[model samples]
Target: MINEPSAPTATHEFDLTTAPIESFTALQEARQEVFSSERAHDAFQRTIRGLQPTGPEGLRRGLGAWMIGDYEGACDALSAYASDDVASFTHANALMTLKRYVEAQPIFKRLAEKYPGEPKAQGGYAEACFEAALSEHGEHEIDAICEVYERELAAAGEGFADSAEGQYLAGRAAEVRRDWQLALDHFGKARELNPAMRRNLFHLGLRAERCGLDLEALVAYQQLASLAPVDLPAMMNLGMLLEDLGRDQEAAACYDVIARSRPMDRRARLYLSDAVAGMDMYYDEDQERKEDRLNQILRIPITDFELSVRARNCLNKMNIMTLGDLVKQTETELLSFKNFGETSLNEIKEILGSKSLRLGMGRQEAVLSIESTQQRYVSGENAEAMNRPILDLELSIRARRTVEYLGCLTFGDVIQHSEEELLGMPNFGVTSLTELKEKLTIFGLELKPRQ
Candidate 1:
């Protein structure tokens, strides 16, 4: 006969169907413990190697090692499954973490275009942009490159609305464009979508406030104060807005709260002092204005105007509780009061001149009059002669094109507008208004007729 092939004997084999899922769960728990334990990073290195060619199993193994700073293991595992978008994105990130920019570039570029609006794609593109900008170029050129990436990423906005990284990139891009409105919109939208996104809300509020969107900015700062832990900026911004809104009591409350929590807050203290000083100055200016008006009308030899009750109340807060206290300071010092503007400053100067007793008299005054003179105005020239809507302002060529698309032409048309109304315009967001506000503030102008 012939030697027949003997039947293969069965080795000890665990039936996968019969095995409890708990066994795998237990393994994962064990792996996590080991991963977090000191000196146990290398414990899984051999296990990862054994898991190769097992689909995502091998990727997981590679990721664990990579997370622990094992570049070789990460590359080995990640390279084995290079076509997987998630795997490729993760691997690209690992390379970036390792400062392997040159190696990470192509991988990210490939994934970004492939997955356009995905978080991973957006993040990868942003990183690539950063890498490109940092590579041996002038700062301005780098800024331009970064801006291009920002616009592209923002336009590719699915996951970006809620991503801190996305918001940050978008904001930076807007800043590069010098488009404050776009920056504000991106930052604000990010905060609205994800309240915990760090620092974006604060920046948005500050920039908005600087552009004269005080109400909108106040809301931003308040949200920031509530959402952010120990955010000094938010508190400071809140206090500033309260002061601006003429809510002295509320401002004092905000200041006290900040001071109690952080006694070393210098800006808070300065603001409080300024508020106190402002109140007193207002009263004094009113009294002076009154005296001047009375003297002018009666043809009496009066040196100054009398303060109104409202003005007196303001002065009391500033420590200018009386006329003597008022005369001791120059017109510029009085004009520093929050509500006291250029018009008030002129009134003070005229009164002092008439009295022949200038503030600080003979000595050079510490309070130099910074009162800017107004151009002579023909009566009725300030307001628009044509009661036509604000849509006729003749905005820049680009702005006009946009407005025409939106079917707008006059100021009255814009007055009743809300954010939703304006955003409906193609390519228009809060950014356009941000620019408009800046232009208006420059001319001592306001939107909505100062209501």
Candidate 2:
């Protein structure tokens, strides 16, 4: 490693545990600087790296970890002690940062109850409860948690309602209740009060977009995108809106920022690619839209269409779980299955035909079936059962598809398909394999062992 100068130290050594909350304002400003100034972020990281996460310096380490966006480290380091309420707040905030909302709730609640006059504690409790409420399954449970949020807001009264943060909170609550106009109004007011406020700006842009105030949404997103320490989701939403408005160059810049930050974000990369393609001299707008439409159609789940029980069962057994998957199967393949007769065959053909597709339109070359190389031809009563039509087995679509899609024509053919082969088909997961095995057990036969 190259030798480097020491990280810049603070003007004065301060202990977070004993310091007033405002003592953090300078560091908060500095943290923002880290994003805008390359060397500053590196220095911040270096300072954080020098701190130990255990022993006497653990609390500072946790705080440093948080500043550097290492929330997991902050959670672990901060949890070591109940040093002070400030430290506890840091630990709780870290938990919330990592989306451990349930764990953060009680901490915020205790802090809120203990320091009833402290706005941060109350806000933290309300925010934590609201977030936790969204993850709850039962409607009543969600309402109960939301009730706490309402109570906390009500307790804040008129003074809180007058503030920017209060308006932002109220905007979110309105959104939860699906009061779109109210959400937009509150978010707008919050934006006016504090244009620099991060969350308020994002929600304002989102709520404005929902309300069809495109210009307003665009303005909010532009302002947000200009701020330091980038919000990836906000940037993504901004890019989408820009693309919709034919601002491909600007959209590409937004995507480029996200792509650089997260190299693994395929969506960002794809968006960037498309945006860049828009600038190409020979770009075909109509062709791009047709391709997009085709992709959308190909992604349609099989469940979206109505089919007769027999047809549905056949498709399920064939592991053809989407419209695209159905188009990949030939008439011969469908008819070859003992139970998949002309009526079911006609049903699939008609659906695909309506969508300008035909059976086997996209079929890959046939692969050799595991059955073809595996078992001996049967004889006697066992042989008779083996010769029976696959439909006679009355197996689920999953089991049926698993066996037949690999050229299984009868009960004997089904048994010839190995465990691994059966589990390899589209939408035929392990659970389906287990069910197939259990159903086969009723007929006194099991699948060929895994290869």
Candidate 3:
């Protein structure tokens, strides 16, 4: 780590625009001192603004502007110095900041070829090519440029492996070639080398997700999202992963950032609303606890209760080994069993009566007698819509979770269930039902209606 260098003691010596740098070392030291702190930068900016330098007007003023974080001024001043190598390089760097990748590419390429031994020139050219490869309408030969990128990267070899930027360029080339695995590997290595590189972290998260590395993707996105000036893509992916992991509160926070930033993003808005609703969702713990105790009682072994040998033998033959199974049998069914006479029946009836249960009660409660009011599966007028994936509905979280839990991969499976059946799911509510109904309405479909 370089120590912070102190600013000049004299005000006159601080003017970067006028001071003729004596040597490479002096220029480097002066640049370091100027950038050491915000106060120093501001002071340098003020001094640079007040001086008239003796040199190529654009080169002197533009170089000073570039150093003090004034890209617009640098670009304006350097616009006329196309023939100067330093001006061309600085101009290309500023153009990159303004997202003029095509304009920057040739400039950096020229500089890289002219100064083959300079790592900075080569790195800049590689970056421009990578950015160009990513643009949808690149206005350049993306494949050709990617090939060039690969050649440069390969020439650097393991020497470049020691650099985060070199590995990142390799990943970008691999991505451009649709080599997902190689891209993932390079991006992962780049992230390990420099965790602070936002683009590297973003690509690492994306590649990890595509390769099914859920936990690693989650961590990568989390780190990127935590950094300043929130990255929209990172936030979106983090929210999705968090939602899938059932971290609704954290997921809501992520979606909320995107939703607030880009109000017109419908997907992000929907996700935010769903996550917030999930955070407020109700779970009937009391009802679940009561059902749990009831299930325990029902699961008790029939043999644990008092019974005549004949009764026990009859139950054993019928495979009615538990109180739950015994309850599922009606009197008529039990009577049909050979050797199960009145005394055995009376004894069984008495035992169940003591527990306030009757024969066939479990079966009665377990069966769904209501039939679908319409055809539930694909085969008719709405068959095409029914055959579509559940994702077509763009459902809110609770509804989607319930259907997914029920193994509904297509709308057909979802339509097979009644509104009450869906509402019975944990966290699924009337609002989700209404939202679902609205979406289905678009395709002229609805949940199976109950009679």
The Cα local distance difference test for each model comes to 0.54, 0.68, 0.69
**Root-mean-square deviation of every model:** 27.1, 25.9, 25.1
lDDT for predicted candidate 1 compared with the true structure: 0.54
Better of 1 and 3 by lDDT: 3
Would you list the rank order by TM-score, best first? 2, 3, 1
> What lDDT score is found at residue 107 in candidate 3?
85
- Which pairs clash (backbone N, Cα, C closer than 3 Å) in model 3? none
lDDT of 1 by residue, 157-205 (tens): 6666457668766775675567898888887777776564435677778
Candidates in order, TM-scores: namely: 0.33, 0.54, 0.42
Candidate 2 is scored at a TM of: 0.54
What is the overall TM-score of model 1 with all chains considered together?
0.33
Worst 10 residues of 3 by lDDT: 366-375
Which portions of model 2 miss their true places by more than 4 Å?
A: 1-24, 138-148, 280-451
Question: Whose TM-score is greatest here?
Answer: 2
* Best-performing candidate as measured by lDDT: 3
Off by over 4 Å in 3: 1-99, 110-120, 133-146, 156-158, 262-267, 281-451
